[model samples]
Target: MTALPDDLARALDDALDRVPASRLAPVVERLIGDYRGGVATVSSRQGPILRTDDDAAAYAAYRMPATYAAVHDGLSRAAEVVGRLAPRTLLDVGGGTGAAVWAASRLWPSLRAATVLEGSEPVIALGRRLATGADDAAVRAARWERTQLGAATTLPEADLITVSYVLGELPEPVRETLVDEAAARASTVAVFEPGTPAGYRRILAVRERLIAAGMGVAAPCPHDGACPITGDDWCHFAARVDRTSRHRSLKGGTLSHEDEKFAYVVATRAPGQHADNRVLRHPLQRKGLVTLRLCTGDGAIADRPVPRSRREHYRAARDTGWGDAWPPP
Candidate 1:
């Protein structure tokens, strides 16, 4: 679980205070419906997701924390493998409210500049407002541009590019084009989506395209060969987020936290060291044995049991969680 930095949390809390949760509740509901049902095409009657200030505010309140946690987790995994990603610039495509920007800055404090390209003016405005209170200079001075992402859009060059929770909103062709463009423009690219079957399919497609574009996968997948887990199972990870009072109010949830399950791929221009195996599910502990489901570097999924007799190995297995690299890095 990755928590938002204190300054960023305070910034979000302050922004939520200005908008009444009562008004944002319905908007949040509508947004949820829109997301669950899938956003309609630009020509469709339903139109875009963030249409007004309230809509943007509601989206930020409901989604920012989860998106931040997902992106942070993905980046952290990438950092572990890639090692010392001293990226100076970042470009966040379709970055509604700049959640990805904050996540990236936290991991790579070396980031000196950032540009967030969003389609909604309200989202960009609200994102700018929230960023103004950020402690990170790069986040505070980030450039927010309103650009409709499509097949014809050209992405600016950057050391790192993040597209989080945005691909589902675009059509297939546009999704392919945007991903190809990101691969072409940035040295490193990290993409995130909902943890649904469809989201896994999209991530699989992106992974293939990125590898086709000559990019090397830096995280999640230990090998860039082919995803071995087949059938009904989808490759995704859970990121737990601590909800704010406003977050709970808007979503009308009684729990203090929520698990945001997301699928992501981190690819880089240069080849980097990869984990030997990636844990696919929570380790099952019973008696003196621990069962671990792992995606090995040879592009195969297997179940390995660690017995207590192997004290050091058993200890590592017991401590390992889902989505962690096996053998404790």
Candidate 2:
């Protein structure tokens, strides 16, 4: 697992000072219940959900680490496909606790300013506090705005924009409105949601809408046509995050690491080279052959075999991990 960004690591440590794991455990458990009971669903009409101060603190402690890691990885992979890009500004819509901005700042030091738009007061307060001690001047001074999402909402033009883990909580009309707004305001847009089938469906819908809006598919998908993945299979990726002792205590987990599965799409206004194939599953090596399931550039799924007789390719396949662009380096 990759280490958390130094500033974010310090920020999280600072937050832990205000809300210890002991005080955060019950909130984490309650949230788990809400999720399991299917009561955590989002609606467009709903106001700021994390009402209490403790609720906001607990959420930041438990969720921020995994989300930061996921968004960081997503942006890095997207950069690989899009080549060199230096964005001057960023807008993070529905950016609870500002995880996406922290990730973006790490990747794009060229960004002079960043803004986080969120409705929850407690969450926004916590977000401001989290960045209060950051080493980066831009991140430390990032603007946090109290804003709602809808057709009436106006967005600031930015080089890159991210809407992470927020779309699934909105109604269809609102979701469409936000996507359209994002496409209009930014040259690059990235959306992320949970790894569930429902989440994948949301990503697919957003992908189609963005393409229709004249944005090119930049990563994960090689082409801008229809997605080849169908029922029971969703295009998602896994990122391993090391859990702190406090994290383990809050969630009552025995493992030292957790795999966060997420569905995401990064779209750009201009066309770029995409990988010929994306590794859909972990490679399996048996005897003299290695097998890989890949989403080909032509928008079809293929099970490719590389045998030992094909020495160079066989070694490459053996080292390939899931979610990596294929024809491994």
Model 2 lDDT per residue over 204-245, tens place: 999999888889877778778788988688899888888888
Model 2 C-alpha lDDT versus the unseen true structure: 0.84
The reply for model 1, stretches above 4 Å from the true place, is 40-45
Give candidate 1's TM-score: 0.97
- On lDDT, the candidate that comes out on top is 1
Best by TM-score: 1
State every prediction's TM-score relative to the real structure: 0.97, 0.95
The per-model lDDT (C-alpha) reads: 0.90, 0.84
lDDT tens digits, residues 221-307, model 1? 999898997899999999999987778878889898999999999999765658889999989999999999999999999999999
RMSD of 1: 1.4
Off by over 4 Å in 2: 43-46
